[model samples]
Target: MSVTAAKGFTAAGIVAGIKENGNPDLALVVNTGPRRAAAGVFTSNRVKAAPVLWSEQVLKSGRLSAVILNSGGANACTGPKGFQDTHATAEKVADVLGVGAGEVAVCSTGLIGVLLPMDKLLPGVETAVGQLSEHGGEKAAIAIKTTDTVHKTSVVTKDGWTVGGMAKGAGMLAPGLATMLVVLTTDADLDSDALDKALRAATKVTFDRVDSDGCMSTNDTVLLLASGASEVTPEYAEFAEAVRAVCDDLGQQLIRDAEGASKDIKVEVINAATEDDAVEVGRSIARNNLLKCAIHGEDPNWGRVLSAIGTTSAAFEPDRLNVAINGVWVCKNGGVGEDRDKVDMRYREVHIVADLAAGSETATIWTNDLTADYVHENSAYSS
Candidate 1:
């Protein structure tokens, strides 16, 4: 289960005739709640999709009653007509669900610079509304896939409340929220302020650190909605932890299912001058294409790691820098340490630890090895 794992939520997915391939392409999630509080995070990119722009305004109210999502077309770069289409879709959903148009959030993903078929999508919204069920979470997740081989969902239940969500992304994964559409729902009785704080905190360390291909999508959006059906307000720390766990799990799933990826790389930067420095160093290492290619070839290339770190503005001494690959110290004192061959690379998960030796701060960034299949898939993506 995904969003519907939480109480007071009903969801559905159905074929919307938007994708020429006849794949499921429309999803709807509604909050039948006594209280509706919501928060959201979107891509930092200046060029945002129409849905993102519309949803940003909707979230300003810090309340939501439903979310409508679709795949097969991003509805981006299509100008005023695209935004009109998005607003019209939301109106259709509101008309069917008998909710305020301002209370509806929309999300779209897939190829950019294309217009969605409103003829098919609007009717699909009605169909999805009719099929809404408590168990439609998985189907909704499947309807949002582009090139993903599998759908992703995560759930965390506390003593009396739960936080659950679904995500879709297999390519164009990078920072600025990892090029994905994620909707998280909870039954805990929390206000918009609490939900906003926890969501920002959770996403800062989770989605903000995943860099698969160093490409961000314009449609990236992550939403958290509260229904207050449980009427159980746990401690802020506990709720925040549950939210972080779910986001972390979903972030890892995105890396595991990265397009054409073979090895999941964990780049840990330790002993940095500050947390910002640590994060900068970790992202630098994770986004280095040379390091990614080398990882795919099972090579413990510490030099590539050092080179990537040197490109960052972080505080570090080349002579004091140390690097470890899969628990084997491959570089120490900025020179070769143990034999590189001793570092085993037989597993699908590779760990790279970089010690800045400047302070006591640390950060980890998740990424995946680059592969030829990635090029082939992306080259023919629009064809």
Candidate 2:
């Protein structure tokens, strides 16, 4: 289940000499399409990466014929030269694929404030183009890794068409789209407007709700390209649901593979005055380092959860709040309800439910427990 799983796409991943360790660091994904309608969502970060800036411009036309990705350097904060390198790379891909430079999108990941070796990247693009294949999606997915231990891909097939995608992220995972570079492809007949509507709606609850390290990246990007290869236009609602399912699956995969995380925590906030209130409360709870540490130690410290909730401006009465850990009501009516020891935390998955008791709206945020491994990994990441 990958980008090439959809019709009208070819992909390749190859070693580009960008990574000193000699892993595959370059990827090319091309839409051999009858229609190149596209939509994109990028990092809201003010300090955007060079590739992100370039891709944003390319996406303004709502068309993309190809995407080139690299995983050894973020190409961010390197000033005009960095952007020049990104442009040169896109131009190379376009040259090889016989498409306009503006029809190419670029994505890069890895350390920030460094320039990519254009000498290697431009040549790598030519090599990647030579190897493009329908079976290359898996390789392309594997090529876009930074700290990720495993590559992630998801696919959902409707009655007549399919939506497939690949995502790369393992750390710096937070709201504002998370530290991820995601490319989704669909053969369903849809215009850029429809794709944008479905992508934004799906990501709002999927990628936007994932808060692993409470940090955002300058290079986060998600793009959806439609080829209209299947020549099938399902109902808008049905198409949107398929996109949501794939994005949700990929989001869960990111949480599961979060750096140094032993427990995947799902924070669900319910009965809020509005959806915004619910999301705010859930993010507050998920981003609470104290609660994450407690979860790491298998301690069902509901107080941390309550304190996190209290910090939010959401509509909730202190006396009417309720909290549950692993299906045990640890806090009911804002007071201790059940034995904390009754909460089980032996498994890798932990569920926390926060009831605001203000309305019927609800939201869920996915995160992971903080641990020593995470600290160690990130502390020495630059090395």
lDDT of 1 by residue, 53-140 (tens): 9999999999999999998888988899999999999999999999998999999987788899999999999999999999999999
Off by over 4 Å in 1: 171-178
- Alpha carbon lDDT of each predicted model: 0.92, 0.91
Worst 10 residues of 1 by lDDT: 170-179
The alpha-carbon lDDT assigned to residue 349 of candidate 1 equals 99
Q: Pairing residues by index, what is the TM-score of model 2?
A: 0.98
Candidates in order, TM-scores: namely 0.98, 0.98
Task: In angstroms, give how far residue 66 of model 1 lies from its true place.
Answer: 0.3
RMSD values, in order shown:
1.6, 1.7
